[model samples]
Each structure stands twice: as structure tokens, then as C-alpha cells.
Target: MAGKSSAGRTRAARRARWWQLTQRWRMVGVFEINTGHEFYSLTSMMKEGMQACIQATSNTESQNSLTDEHFKTKGTQLLEGFEMHTFAAPVFATLRHSLDISEQEFMNSLCPRANYLQFISNSKSKADFFLTYDKRFFLKTQSKREVRFLLSNLRRYMDHLEKYPHSLLVRFLGVYKIVIPNQLKKYFIVMQSVFYPDERINNRYDIKGCEVGRWTDPETGGKQVVKVLKDNNFKEQSIVLGPEKSWFERQVKADTAFLQDLNVLDYSLLLAQQPLHQDELKGKHSFADLVIRTTKSLDIEDYPTHLEPSSVPLLRSRSEEVPDGAVCVPGQHQAAAEGDGEEILAQEINSPAKDTRCPVELQGFHKHHQRLLPNLKNAVHVIDGLEWRYFVGIVDIFTVYSIKKKLENLWKNLRYPGRVFSTVRPTKYSQRFCRWIHEHTQ
Candidate 1:
């Protein structure tokens, strides 16, 4: 009787597998009547956009990587007469090349194989965040106003990327539009995810540095879930960048300078913390296999096997084409080890010119580690919460100086009396933000 029951369970599992094999995969989205046109049309457009990106960044035409010989926008004109724009190869070639993202990988991230898409929603905004199956690029719904702002400043942005191909400025891959017959045109912007799908970040914060309107909304669950937090939350726990503190501070100065000059404001500094030496700090045996533990920390078990960069045809094609002497591989380890990066770090940090570019994210492809060690420099280890590293970048930079901001200022002023908030004019906000960061870093 027990043998018969076991055989019956085996049969049920086999049947489930067979059914799954026959059904293929389902595409998810917000649609009205279940017309399959959305999947077909959008996927095809994304493919075209990918091809264009490949052509733009092809090394056959220009031996120099990301060096624009003669630049042109990469896009596709759909059957419906509307067009979609995406990062074609030549547009930000050096930038993409530096990030080790190939055109095929980029396209796959944005369009993906029809079934490899997952729908995600944001409660704070009308826009929805759609993550590709691989979790490389974040496809976010955008408003016409925001789209226009992006389009208008795109050239300047391209120039910025070109100058500092590896810079940590919010990497915007493409902007796409879909005409919905009777409805308004749907627009989407593809951006790089701050947190890697493989890595685990125990502590994260969306810091605006401003006291006013920076706190996470009270209604949203705090710490229990991912919430955009602000100055007060950050102040509760101090940050120390250790020996590289000076380097980190300088990088922020350079980044903020570019942002301020552009009149871009209201962006948040996204911070992620990764604890190191947990066993040692907790006074446990260090014999618990460090290699295995580290391996598990950056594991990508959740993603499908096909998502690896090497497996993608586009990445494979362009993989060998990375230019010699390129700064794609990080060279910070030796310098950080020797305790002799002040001059070099100074150049990186002090350069506020548009032509200069640097990536200030948690870099190191092999290590991909943040330069920020614990706050051990100023306080005692037991009392100072000093067993972690940090990753930070200024993100959500689409908002530009506009009439909307002016109106917002008027509204905020009326809403909150005897207080100035982050809603200040672009010039004023930039000054405050940069000043605050400088002071805090010091």
C-alpha cells in the first residue's frame, strides 16, 4: 500500500512536468482585453532597438571604443508609425563597454524573451517597474513630462557618459514609447538596478540629506520592507569610509558638481551596506568556511541559467572586442592595499570638469566591493557598529529644473510653515546638498 502511494506521487510529478513543457511561458503586463499585440509589438521593437545599439557601438567602424566618429540616435519606427528609442551601440559605446554590457544583453534586459518578463509596481508613483527575467535593467513606466525632460537632456547626457564612461551617474539605457490606439502613448525608460540580483544588501537607504520631506512615509512598513528612508534614519547610524574616507568624499564632490551644473536636483543617494567579518565581530569561530560563506553571499541562484552574460549571443560577439588598455577592469585593489592613493584619489575626487568621468558605485567585477569600510576610524568597534562596507550612488536624476519645480516650491512653502525643504529651487538645492555632503564627509 505504501509502495503504491509513492508510485502515485511520482506519476503526478511527471504529469506536472509534461504540462509545463507544453505550455511555454506567460507574458505579464497591464492590458485591457487580453490582446496579445502588446507582447508581440513591444518585443519586436526592443529587438530592433537592440540591433541599432549594436550597430552604433560596433568596433568594425571605429577602432576606438565609445569614441563617437559621427553619432546618430538609435531607434526603430514601428508599423503603427510611432518610434521607440534604446541605447544602440554607438550612443554610449564606451560606457556600455566599460560596464561589460553587450547590445544583446542590453536588449534582453529591456525587451527580454516574451515570457522572461515580470511586472512590479511602485506605490509612490503612477509608474510601474518591470524587471527583466535576468534582473539587469529596470523598465520603468514614465509620464510624458518626464519623457520630454529626458529627451531634451539626452544629448548632454550622452556627452557626459562619453567623457566618463564608467561614471556612477544613474545609467539610463533607453527610452521607449508604445502607441495604444485610442489611449495615450505609453513610455518606458530602461535603467540599471542599483542592487545586483546576486548580492545581498542588509541595510539600504534612499537618502536626500534634507531634513524636510526626507523621512519614509509613516504608513509604509519601516525596516520590515524596502522603504525610501531619509536624513533622520541615516543619522541614527553613523557612516565611516575608513582609510578610503577621503577618496569617497572627493568622489561625491566631483559627482555633485556635475549634477549641480546641470541644474538637476531632487535626486537621492541610495546606500547599501554589506557586513564583513561577521564571525570575528560576533566572537564566533572563524573556521566556518569563509570561501563558502562569501560564495553564498553573491550567489545568483534565483535567476535562470540562460541569463549569464557569457551565454548571450550579443555579449559573446562583443566580448573579445573590448579595447586593450581600457579601464574596464578595476585597478583600485593595489592602490587601496598600499595606502598610497591620496594623489591618485585626489585627481579622481577633485576633477569637477565635464570631460572627467569616474564610477563611484560598489565596483570591482571580481570583488565588486565598495571602498567604504567601517567607521572604525573615529569610534570603538563594539560601540561603533563598525563591521560593514557601503555602496552608494546618486539616482533618480530624470527630474530637471522646470515650471513643475517652481509650482512645487510654492505648494511646499504653503504646506509647511517656518521651514525650508528639499523643494528649493535647483540652484539652491544643489548648493545645500553639496554643502551638506561635504560637511558630513569631513
Candidate 2:
């Protein structure tokens, strides 16, 4: 009986060892299967002539660059032994059953940094075999430095690949350095869409190409046709400027008369060329307006002096109640009480003033009302420098209102670097301009 029991124990131990070995081999097989799929996808793509685009830069130049002769001869010998096999079916089945990734998603996963590196590294052996067998793959892969950068910045490359799978690999690589500007451009586009309150300009005006004209009050059955005079007598318009014959001076004089006749609110003329309706012009009631007419040939120095800063208030009151979702100053509380003010006040204070400047007395307004200043900062950063320059004159007025409201709400929590009045004045204009730019650029 004792002998039989000992034999039974030995048999059970042998079965346990066999199970362990099987499990070990199973895991190894899984790794190889995954690695093999990556290899097959890369080779297939390469053979099909789907070239990866790469951007070049001077900084990437190597001092000790190798000539083609150094690698080509040896690379050719290595290409003879490699073989290309299709694994689309097995790869698809494995992804479905094991990785649980759809075939499309699995393909997309190949785009980002980490996956790209893994794809390249896992296939190195196969690539080496191809190099030994055919040599072409080696020559193509070795021809560029960007391929190395893609391999090196694998993690970032992978994250971006997933986020922008459709983007070219070369552009994907450039994103590491240019991401801030690119993201800023995208954010500006989104903010413009939000702020501009898209007016159907097509419905309001007859703007064929660049010439603008519209029948005023068409919907109300009135015919007040506003038309700009055509520039007739082309030769007389083109006369060179001199003491007695300054054609530019004459045009400025004519333009001033034309603008005055229109009675466009002073600053409204700055944006007159913009496809805005009359009602939109009326919306600028919260701020003072300026009008200037300059000929194409007139230098900026020749422009007339703008209104004195002292004439404008440090803080201008809104003509209407603060819109819902707009951040406001304490002075606006009276206006807020008149509308759905509760909703604006109910918003949790998470952001700060869009304008960094706010008076001490007004600083507490944003804290009390719940504003998000960080978000406002982020929004301001979205405008491109070039776009800002193009609309610099008009943006001054719009940013002032936007900044003042933003500061008024976040007055308690905000701080600035200069005198309250000085900081407030310029900041007001900047905020208004940025806000307007944020709107129109979209």
C-alpha cells in the first residue's frame, strides 16, 4: 500500500511540471504572434510604396555623414535571404480574439510614436533579412535622419500618432517642436467660432467678389440703397504725388467726406469693410468710436491724432445687461439683476480675468461671481501674432470691453504691473481687440 501511494504522488508532480511548461511556451507564442503581425504590416506597406514623408532641417545635418558606398555594398549582400509573407488574416484574427482591437484601430495604432518605434524595432530582424535579400529596404530606411528622430521620440510620436493618425509621419514628427503654435492656431479658430455669433452676411448683403452693396431694410419693405461711388477717371486717380499734385491727399479728403456722409460711428469705419450688418454696428454702443481715412500711399505718421485717453472713462458701463455666460464687474450687478443674472452668478469661479489688469476694489467681483481666469489666459494665447497685427486698430476697442468685464468679475483675485489707470486703459483696448479678433478670425 505504501509503495502504491508514493507512485501516485510522483505522477501528480509530473503533471504539474508539464502544465507550467505549457503556459510558458503559450506566453512566448503570444509575444511572437504580436511581433510578427507588426513586422508583416510594415513590410507590406513598404512594398506597396507607401512612403513616409519626413521634414528636413539644417540642425539635423551630421558631420560624419556616410556615403552610399559605405553601406550599399554590404547592405546588398544582406538582402538576399529575406522573404515577404502575408499575415493579414492571422493578424486580424489575433487582434480580434486576443488584443480585442478592431482591425481599423489596430492599423491606426501604428501611427503614434511608441507604436511606430515598436513597429520599427520588432521588424528590424525582418528588415535586416530584407536588407540581406533585396537591399532596397535598407537604402530607403537609411536615406533620412527623420526616421531616426521618429524612432527616438517614440513615446511622444505614439501619443500624437493616436491623436492625429491621418497626419503624415513627417508632419507628425515636426509637431514636437511646432505644437504650441499649431495648437494656438486651432484654439483661435475655435474661440472665433464661439465669440463672433456668426451673422449670415450672405443674407444681409450683396457682396459679389470684393464689391459690397446692399438694399437696406429689404425685409421691412424700404428701399434705402447704399452704394459706394466707383473710382472713375482712372488716369486722374493715378497722378504722382508732389506739392501741387498729391493724389493720395486728395483721396483721403474724399474718403473723409464719404465716411462723414455715412455717419458711421468713428471706429465703425475701421471695420466697415467687414461684411457686418447695420444692427451689428449699432451693437458697438458700449464704447466710443473713432474714424480715420488714409490713402493707400499715405504713411501711418500722416494719420490724424486719435482722441485723448482722458476723454474715455477708465471703466465704461455696458449699454445693455451682461449676456449670460459673460463675466462681469461689480458695477454690472445692477444690470445683472435685471436679466437672467442668477445663471451668470451661479457659474463656479474657476477662470480669471481675460485682462490681467483689475482695480483692487473690483478684484473681489470675479471671486464673488465665480470666474475662470486661467481659461481666459489660455484663450488670449490662441490668437496668432500676424492675425493680431492685421486687426490691431479695430481690436483695441473690442478688447477693452472684454477685458474690463473680465477684470470686473475677477477684480479681487487679479493683480497687474503698472498704475491702475494706465494699465486699465491699454488693457481695456487690448482685451476688446483680442475678443473681436477672436470672433472675426474664425
Candidate 3:
């Protein structure tokens, strides 16, 4: 009798402990779902949307196949209160237009009774938040003014929800308002919305220029004049002549290895060969003409009068074509002669009787060459696609302190061949190519 009583007591104690453990787990699960970042309300809306989808397909085998346990899941419970009339028709119509799919097909693929129910259920059970990856749905609504109006209405409805924040709804509607039919436009909108909405708005709505006045260089102590060119002009120039002076400077600074191997003289010659005359027509013609003519003219003071020279000839010569004993390349000397005559002519044409101070000032040929060549080549290498990709990838991966150890290990396995030249590698005669890359990248 005593042994039986003891066994019975032990069994009772075990059962009680198991019951308490189960209740504790239930409470912990409830806390995870309902406290902190709970999406209870969003889950409710998702469920409602899902149930409507299910009811619409009630006659289909897909709907009928769902087990009783599926209905008992949190997703189904949320959908129990859903009304198909609220979202189904609008959502279907929008998707039909955006995806170029029939309403029936979209419903079959996207809001399938099983997927709808499963997603909602999973959101309620496991996910901290619910997000739809269906871009077609957003795009469809964005393409139509009527859909936008409906979204505005939806925003108002959400605003009326007791727990919904006004700021959140405002941001959501702001995004909905900016969608367009073009995929590129839509992509731009989405990117801006996710990463830079405030910056976009500030650019769009704030037309006022800098209140603090123009930027002054700290080292130079001179007011910096920022020339804001139109996008079309900037892109055109970039494609035709390459990136602007500032872009080149930044690239040169970023790649130290490229700078070290660069042949300053060859690099300067290439820059001088660029059609500086064509760029002169765009308001800032004189600056480019000055830089080009000054580099070639060995006589620095001659650049100011080179822009309007008589009989400006288009000279084409290779590196070997340079005349013997020419301090600068023969092509550069010819360009300078033509540019000087052109500048004089331009000055006479633009102002007949008044003498204006030309901005062109010449430094010594060798001195200017030394100063500019390294920077120019470094800039060119930095912009080279292969070089830029390699360096940028390195910078991005190695910056994180926690990942540095892992990256160091991986770096051992990644072979960087010294012979692998960048996309802009100089022809076989070029000795400065590697040096240029090394200087800029380092």
C-alpha cells in the first residue's frame, strides 16, 4: 500500500510539472506575438484579405483541400472577419493592368487560396512583420490615378485605426502618390522611397540655394564657384569627353597604386589631345582651351591669345610623328599655335575695342607637366570599370571590423594576378599603367 501511494505521488508531480511547463511556453509565445513589435492589426488586415481570396475560390479544389487544422491557424482566424468586397476587385484590376495578366491568372498565381492563407498564418506565427514582394501589385496601383485616389482613401482609413500612427500613413501615401507607368520611373521612385525620400523631397520642394553662401576651400581660402550643369549636358560631356575635372581628382586620390606607376608625360599628352575646342562652345570654352593650349605651348603666356587664331587646323599625329628636338609633342605644339590664333580672333569678335583680362596663366612646361600628369592618369585608372570594381569591392568588404577576420582568411584564397590589367590598360609600350593603378588604389 505504501509503495503504490509513493508511485502515485510521483506520477501526479510529473503531470503537474508538465502542465506548468506547457502554460509557461504558451505565455512566452503570446508575449512574443503581442508585446514589443506586434503586427496584430496588420495581421488582422492580411487575414481579412486572405479569407476573401479563399471565399472567391470556394468552388475550386484548392480551397476545399485545406485541412481543418489550416482554418484553426492564426492566419485563418485573422481572415475570419475579411470582406472580399473591400480589396479583391481593386487589387485584381490593378494587377491585371500592371502585370499584363488576366485577373483570373493573377488570382491563381499570387493570391492562391493556399498561399494567401499560408503567408498570413506564417506572419502571425513566425514573422515579426508581413511584407509582400509583389511589385506588380504596387506598380498597377501606381499606374492609375483612380488607384492612387483609392490608396489615399485607404490611408485615411488606416489613419482612423486607433493604434495607427499618422506619420506612418503619411509616408505610405507619399510613396503611393509618386508611382508612374514607366518601369525606370517606378524603379527610381521605389529606390528614392526606400533610401532617400527626404533627400528627394528636399531637392524637389526646396528651391532655395545655400543660405550660408558658396563653399570656400579651407586650404586655398578661396570661394568655390560650383557650376551646376543640366543632367543632359553633364551626361553628354561624360560620354563624349569623359568625366569632369572634379571626378578625375577624386579618382586619382582613391587609387594610390595606379599613381605610382603612371608616366606623367604620356598621361599629360593624352589629356592635351582631347578635343578641347569642341567643349569651348558650351560657355566655359576658355577654361578648357587654356588648359590644353598652356600644356602644349612651352611658352605659357601665349595661351590667352590662342583661342581665336587665324587658320586653326585639325592636326592628327601619333606619338612617333612628333618632330625631333620638340620639347613637347609636335601635335601639342600645333594645337597651341592653332589655339592661340583662335583665341585672338575670338577676343576681337566678342569685344572689338575693349581689352579684357584673359584668365589663362601659364606655369613652366615641365613643372605643370609633373604636377598634372600623375593626377590625370590616376583619375583615368580609377574610373576604369575593372579597377573601380576591384577597389570598391575591397573597401566595402574590409571596412566592417567584425568581418575583417573572415575577409583576411578569404583574402588568402583569392588570387590577385599581377598581370591582370584593368579595362583601360595602356598598349604594350606603356610602363606607367601598373604604377597609375597602384597609386590610385592604395
Candidate 4:
């Protein structure tokens, strides 16, 4: 019994040490980011690609419209045994700038002082996700076809964002490609995290306004805390919106229309729920102020960035099999580690002047809410009666209604007649999605 107890204590100590070294960092199996072993070895290709892309963005001049040259501006770099390719470097750079993410801030967020990139497990999509230490942005692995579609519709998407600056659509910050020694290729698209405000989200749902297969299994029960509930799992609640309601309703309509025009489908409104504190409900603290305070509250000195293990460890081999699960599912095991290094909020200083060219509805909406940060005001909806603060954004906008989707939709409809599957035609899908959102939010 004494020996068994000793073994248990030893295991506990090792676990504590791991958490200290990683500051509660979570990874897939044994995958981890160690500077000594990984900085110049496993992840070197990605680091080199990012550095090259940042430099290309720094050198390129901003353009209102993309030209053939912009798409052709391929910056290639040859690292140890890997080849890194950046697609439309200047064009993505302009997108980053337009979002007010400066080059320095961008570089810092991706390649932080800790040199750690946490792997997100079991993404429902075909792609894998890797989050930065600060969690400001995450890299989603994409298919070559998806990349092509995005580039083709790049101009229209940019125009939409420019016109409807407050659009709740997910922001794609950058795109990249890496070729391994065997000539196998990997594509990555970096996107701003919708829930990056560092708020404590109690619940999350991917609402598509569809009913079939949208409900969570009753067996999960309390375990749902780690899972993202779907449309059917969502409870119907009356949500009260401030003046921002007009802006949100209008933007959703416009954004969905934009997606329909691009033939994009299978997107959903990603919603997160945060239970409000008594002080927050009483207006002692505005949600905006809480977000800002939470962001700046983290003192960098508290978490020293230079800690390293006594010796370099072997790198974990990359698994070719794509994990099957939801995006960024904070599994029960990772609960403790998920909160350690939450966010290092990127403050946007010297923001561009508001465009007076906005339509009267947008102008009126901006007048009242402009005082709050754009992201804060746009993303948050506090319902005092419900005692919940809701964070929402439109996500998974890449799936296009191509020939493959058409066939899939047809097959599904035949299999389950009168059932709403997510793979419908773009126009009808967007209309249903918008209408569902309108009805649910009301």
C-alpha cells in the first residue's frame, strides 16, 4: 500500500510539472511545442512561412482591388527539407491591415515569446486547427479546392466586408501552403477566433436553423459542457437586443445575401453563452468594460515566457488521420489546462475613420454603439432577464454549393424526405438560415 501511494504521488508531481511548464497547455496525445526541439525542427517550416509572408506583406503596397499579379505573387521559401509557399501574400496582407491588425501585432500573436502553438483536437470539419498561445487567432488546415474557391471569391468577400464593416462573418486573416519532402502539400487558413474576448463562456451552439441531426445525444447530459450543442439542442429563449438589434438584423440579411451570391452554403451562426454576474446585470460593469478589463488584467510578467525543460524531447509525429469531432472541443480532460493562458488582447490603436458613405441605417446604428469597441459591441448581446451574455458570429462559410454538394444534397433529401439537411442550394439555405436566426433571436 505504501509503495502504491508513493507511485501515485510521483505521478501527481509529474502532472503538476507538466502544467507548470505548459501553463495548463493542452495537446493531442503527446504533441507539444518545445523551443529547443521544435523551433528549429518540426515547426520550422511553418515559422519560416509565416516570417516570409510577414515580410512580403510589409513590402507590398495596398490595393483597392486585386489584380492577376496579386494572385500570382507567390512567395516561396526552402526550409530544411520542407518547401513553404504563401499564396497571394500581398492580398492577404491588405486584408490583415484592413482589419486593423498591424504587422507587428500579427507576428507577435502567431509567433509569441513562449514559442508554443497549441493543437485543437477533433475538428468537425476535414481540417485540423492550431491555436496560438494567446488564442487571438487559430490556423485551420484547408483543402486545395477550398483555397481555390476562396481566392476566386476573394474580391467579392472583401467588398462585402468593406461595405458592411460590422458584418458578423468570420474573418480570414491569412492563407498559406507547405510542401513536405515527399511533395505532399498542406494548406492553412488563419482566422480570427469569434470568442477571443477571453470571456467565460458557459455554453456554445452551432445553430443552423435545421432540425435533423442537430440535437445533442441525451447520454452526454452534463458532459455537454465540453461539447458544442447544435440547433435542436438549443433551448428557445426570448433574447432582448439593444439598439444594436437593427444593425445586427440588417447585417445578417446582407451577409447571408452576400454568401448566397457567392454560392456558399452550410454556414451556421456560432453562438456562445456566458452567465452574467450580479454586478454585470446591474450595469455596475458593462460587458465591454469587462472584456477590456479581463484582457488587460493578465500581467505578462506573471507568466514568464522563457521557461524550458531540462532537456530537449523527441517531436511527436504528425498523424495523417483527420480527427472526427467538433471544432475546438475543450474536452473534459483539458478543462483544467484551457484557462491558464487565455488571451493577450490585441489593442487596435488609431483606428481608421468611420466611412460616412454607409447607408442611413448603418449610420444610425453606429451613432449609439461606436463608443464600444467594434468587436465588443458587435459580438456581444446581453440579456439581463435571461442572465446571459451571448457572443455570436457566422462561421463555416467556405463550403460552396458545387456539383459535389448538389449530389450530396439530393442523396440526403431522398434518404430522408422533408428533412432539412445542411447541404441545400445556396439561395434557399441562406434564406432559411436568416429566417431561423430572425425567429430565434426574437
Candidate 5:
């Protein structure tokens, strides 16, 4: 009973007082797959601790009263207090229950280490953005208006997903709220990161196809980190989708229908290019492989370390509490393993670099030092004279054509001399965006 339920917030919600928290945009965390390093929030650490304390108190207080069926039906309670609401999604809940993992394991994946959410110096969105430690997830600040909009259309969105399971829209996994005693409430929407773990993106662009605020000149103010260049910048690179161009266009059309139907706009075709130097992709003995070598040296965290001290006690023997018909299990999940465990571990860690090389076969490389791109045999595709796989996702879909955006556009129009701003009407924006993508998608 610590945190107010989403139901409670929905009951008391109104527009006027809650729209004040859209000031600074601070981003949190990132996860690197190759290195297995991830950014996690300390507040997440705090939440886990607080959740453990609460669960312990609840268990002790209820004792024999809370039966297995009762606990199973009610679900495990996490942190709660104040007027805000936060809880894991059904997918997470089912996964935890099915796997028989401690609640802390799920929490760790959501918010791992004590990594700080850094401010994205180049961001144009009003909401703060944070990347997870492994960069597989993004945590962003949300405004009251947007949250309400999403809540209103939540069912429609769910139905759409149920209809088209593989729709390219950014996977919206979870939504949450944080309310402090006296401040405006903090809202967060957690999303699945579009890119994959093993891929190294060399050239990336956030293509809105809008002329206004889309361009990030090399001469721009802040130092360039991982640059989210504009449409113009993207065009300059002339990186075409190549043989997969047709497939991409089909995907765009499918995704466009979904967004346009929902009146969603200001979204971008986020494209990341991982130019796998033919040599690097098949680089068996090259120095570029050192990054992977060093990554392997580091001690990777298999589970959230923060939960170890106190949570160890809370995780009572699983077998002792099993119901009459239940099965006893061991290892990571409540499942039995087959085959050599060592082989499975090695396959996961030492997955062959190309078709040829394995970690076991890798020596200090005093013998062979050749560009191995030509020698390795595997699936191949050439894009603009270079072979690469483009990881594409439609992001920033939460921006609705609200009254605030309308006013902002009006002000921008008056503020600027002639042409209406790039952040124009949502319909026009989406049209222009999709058109530009179609035109340049060679």
C-alpha cells in the first residue's frame, strides 16, 4: 500500500496541474552486448531494497494466512508509496513465475547496476531519455498529456499488436509513474531498444524527413557523441538499403498504416548501419578482435548483484514450499538440462566469429595474418559497394498532435521569418517523412 495504484491515479487525474514536468531531458543507462556492460539506475537499486523490505514485512505479518493459491493469484508486490504507480507487465510476471526466478532477477533486468542516466546533449525531445546498461532498453520521461493519451488508446494498441504480432513499432513493454511527496509526478515508458547486441553500428540517422530541426550540422554546439544526424545528413551518406530495399519499403508501409491510424506522428525511421568490414566480420586473427577478447576477460554479471545480500534469505527453499502436484527443479530455471553443459556454455561464449573460427582455435596469431574476408563462407549482401545489415526501427511514436504541440508550432511559425517549421502538423509530418523515406530508399 506504499505507492498509489495506476487505478487510483486514473481516477484522480486531470490535465491542468500535471503538465509541468516536461523541462530537462536526462537519459539513463546503456547496455553493450559484446562487452556485457550495462547502465542501471541507483534508484532501481533503492527500489529493489525497498521491495525486499516490504515483501519480508508482508510475509511475516501474514504468516500462515497467505496461502499458496492466495499468493499466486495476488502476484508478488514490489515497491509502493505516494500517489504514483509502478508494476511489471504480464509478460514479465509470467516469465518470472514460469522460470521460478526471484522477483529481484526481473527487477535487475529492468534496472541493473547503479549506472547514471546521462543527459543526451543532442536530443530535441522535451522528454528526458535514458539508455539501459546493455542498450537493449530505453527509459524515457513522459508528460501527463502523453500518458493520458496512451492510456486512452491502450486497448486499441493492444488489439493492434494482437492482430499484427510483428508490427515494427517500437515494442512498448512497460509504463510506470513515480510520485514524490511534493513534486509533479514522474512518468516513464520503457521500450525495447531497436538494435541488436552483437551488431556494431557505424553510421546512424534519425530520419524524420522534416526540413526543420532535422539537420545537425557538424559545426553544431555540443561535441559530437553518437550523432543522431538529420535527414539531410542521412542523404549525404547515400547509404541505400540495396537488395533489401523492397523488403524495407514493405515494412515501412505496414508500420505507417498502424501509426497513421492511431494519429501518431513525429516518429523517425531510426537506421543504424553496421558496416561489417568483410575482413572484420570474418576477422579470425585480426587486432580488431581484441575488443571481443577484452570483453571476454571481464567478469560478466549473470544476475543482479544488488539482491545478493538481503534477497538470499528471502528466497526460501523452492522445494520445501512446492504444492502436492508441483515438480521440484534446479539450475537457472525450474527445468532439467540435457547434453554437456560445458559445450552449451562454450557455444554461447565462443560462438564462431564467422563460418571458420572458434574461441578454442584462437591462438596468439603468430602464424596467419591475412584479411580473412574473402576466405570465410556465409550469407552475403552488398549495399552501396559495402556489405552490411541495417537495423531499422520506428521510434519516438508517443508524440501526439496535442494542443501543446499546436501552440508550439504557432509560436515557431511567428518566431521564424517565412516557411512553417519542420515540426509541422502531425499528418503533414508523417506524409513528408514517409515520402522522403520512399524517395531516398534506393
Candidate 6:
């Protein structure tokens, strides 16, 4: 009887914690629908607006739709006593399509019926982060200044993605502002999670390539503490990328250059590794094949709008081009990662430069893992003679080298003359970042 009572208390405590985290996002519908009594109509309006945005963008015929005015344009809707505003809906809708995300897939993945957003409070910053139940998308709260900066650079950001589809930069799918009746306004930017497909990451690192204050706290004991280990916490492991090394190097160079051109600094490389045992690698199913098999088991009929396994003709055609045992390194043979990046600083917000190129037509690859492979390929890598699947992406590029950052850099340099800080000038920071990756990664 005592053991049963203790277990009941423990379960109650866990339920309380989960409720505390998720309750704030609840929004009771005017006429509540039975959803197992778990969800409270969260994100209904946001999903509706997103679907409409995608539809409107697809039907538009304007050649200069990606103008500064278009990006600055805001659409507002009032639903269930909450005012929701979508920033640059058409622009971001185009970006979603470019990233190979369909309206149905995005809506289902983000706004599922039974499960809502899960709060993630592990970040160092004060900004709140939420992950959809499926773990496909991440919604991060942004400050007003950060939102302004993103809006100002939305045009160039889209162009960069178009020119270099294999760039490692974190993809921002949508930006929105939510206003509660008689309450404060909240801003959010929806992004692609680096560890998509809900993979189990054995180890991950938030690498800034800086020496000072880059180590994780030894006493910070928690379930989430070890998830995002820092630069100093990262040991020098033998990271063998094989054919992926050259492609990764080139993409990093181009991505950092794009950020540096915009005077952005203090971004980190998010690297995650999923270890695979010999049995899993050599079994009837390979590492990726097992993931696909698991995905298939999860009622593929439910997500009929997404890509069918037989529909990925591009991936199939490319797979045939490679030998049986050869690595399928993405963008390895392509010239897109060469010296294609130009100085985008010359472009102004008023006269937004137009990208005459059409959005990439990925009719069947609407899934997260499908789109992720082209950018930061989570391919199998032999690290220290053990098989591992690697996930890599660049994040937090909104921090520009403004006056505040300049002063902070000045004070830090004076305080520690020889120490390397992550808040250096954007150009210098980019150079150091590239040099560090070259030295650390194979």
C-alpha cells in the first residue's frame, strides 16, 4: 500500500510539471470540441492564417512581390478574443514552399489535434522556446529589435537561400505576433529544428569557437543540461566527415560570409550526433532505413499530403548516380557552394533587390528530413571507428555588430587582452569561426 501511494504521488508530481509548462499556451475554443480533453484549441488561428498565406502566395502573379513594402506588410486577424498578426505572410509563404514545406504538412506538423506546443526553457537566453509535439518546428520568442532586424533583411535572407540551397544556416519559416486582449504582445519566429525526425541525439554541442566563458557548468545538474554542451565542454573527438568534409567547409565559408556581410555576429554551430550500434548499422535495415521504417509505421496514411516514398524521384535519380558503397554526399559535385556569394550590403530596404529565380519545385519532398538533407545533410559518419549520424546547423544570426556590441567587445578586450571572445567584429568573428571549424573538424 505504501509503495502504491508513493508511486501515485510521483505520477501526480510529473503531471503537475507538465501542466505548468503547457498550460500557458491553452486557448479554449468558443465551442469546445472533444480532443481527448488534452488540447484546448491552441494555434487554430495561427494555422488558419498560415494556410491562407500559402494559398495567396501561390496564386500571386507579381514579379516584384518580394519588395520591402511586401515584407513590411502585416496581416491581422481576430479570433477567439485574441488578435494574431502575421508579418510578411506572402514572403514567408514563398520561403516555406522554397524549403519544400506544403500547407497541409506544415499545418498538421505544427498544429496537431491532440498535442500542442511543448515549452522548452533550456536556452541560455531569456527568450521562450516552444517545440511542436512532432518536433518538426521550433517557435522562438524574439525581441522587437530582433524582429525589426529580420524584417529589414528578409529580402536578402530569401535570396541567400535561393542561391545556395545547401546552406547550413537555420531556416526561419514564419514570423508572427500575438496580442492577447488587454495583455502584452508576443513575437515569434518559426524555425526548423536541427535535430528533425525526432532523432535521439547521443551528444550535441553549441560551438562558438571562443575560449572565454564557453564551458558548461560542472555543477549544473539537470536532465536538459547536457543536451547543449558548449565549446569548452566539447572534447576534441575524431569527427570524420569523409567526402562531406569539403562540402561542409565550403558551405560554412559561404554561410559565414553571408552573415558577416550583414554585420551579424555571435552565432553558434549546433552539432548533434546520433550514435548507432554495430547491430543497428549492419542489421536488415541500415541507420537511415530504420528511421524511414519507423516513420512508415507511424500511419503514413494520416499524412497523405506529405511526400510518398515513391514520389522522391529526384533523390531516387541521384541515388542511382552513386555507386552502391559510395557515400551520397549532398552538394559535393555541385558548383553552387563555390564563390557565389556577393556583397548583399549594397542592397537597401527601400529598393529591395529582386531574385528573378523561381522557387525550387520540390513537389514531393515536403517532409523535414527530406528538405534537411539538401542543406545540412544528416548523413552517416564514421567517428572514431564507430558509426554515427550527424546533424549540423548555424543558429542565432540576428545579433549584429551594433554600438552596444562594439562597446561590449571593447570592454572584453581590455579586460582580457589575450582571450578570444565571440563578440568581436562580424568580419573577424566569421574568420575565427571558419578557422576553428577547419582546425577542429576533419
Best by TM-score: 4
Q: Looking at model 5, report the run of 10 residues with the lowest lDDT sum.
A: 363-372
What digit string (tens of lDDT, one per residue) describes model 3 on residues 97-128? 32224445444433432211111111111212
Instruction: Name model 6 segments beyond 4 Å from true.
Output: 1-70, 117-122, 218-226, 276-386
Q: What is the C-alpha lDDT of each candidate?
A: 0.50, 0.24, 0.25, 0.60, 0.46, 0.61
Output the worst ten-in-a-row residue range by lDDT, candidate 4: 343-352
The lDDT of model 1 is 0.50
Q: Total clashing residue pairs per candidate?
A: 9, 42, 39, 0, 19, 0
Work out the TM-score per prediction.
Answer: 0.59, 0.15, 0.18, 0.68, 0.54, 0.66
Q: After superposition, how far is residue 397 of candidate 6 from its true place, in Å?
A: 0.9
85-183 in candidate 6: lDDT tens per residue? 888877776766655577667777766654445443335798866666666787788999999999888889888876565578888888888777676
Question: Candidate 5 at 338: error in angstroms?
Answer: 57
Candidate order by decreasing TM-score: 4, 6, 1, 5, 3, 2
Cα lDDT for residue 16, candidate 6: 96
Write down the RMSD of all candidates, one decimal each. Answer: 13.0, 28.9, 28.7, 16.7, 21.1, 11.5
lDDT by residue (132-234, candidate 5, tens digit) is 5544556677887776776566556655544433345666655566655574467777666665442355656788776666677644354434556777777
lDDT of 1 by residue, 117-164 (tens): 444222366666555565456667788878777766666776665444
Off by over 4 Å in 5: 1-42, 45-84, 91-106, 114-119, 196-199, 219-224, 277-386, 403-421
Q: Candidate 3: list runs displaced more than 4 Å.
A: 1-36, 54-84, 87-91, 94-130, 133-148, 151-442
Error (Å) of candidate 2 at residue 146 is: 1.4
**Which 10-residue window in model 6 sums to the lowest lDDT?**
349-358
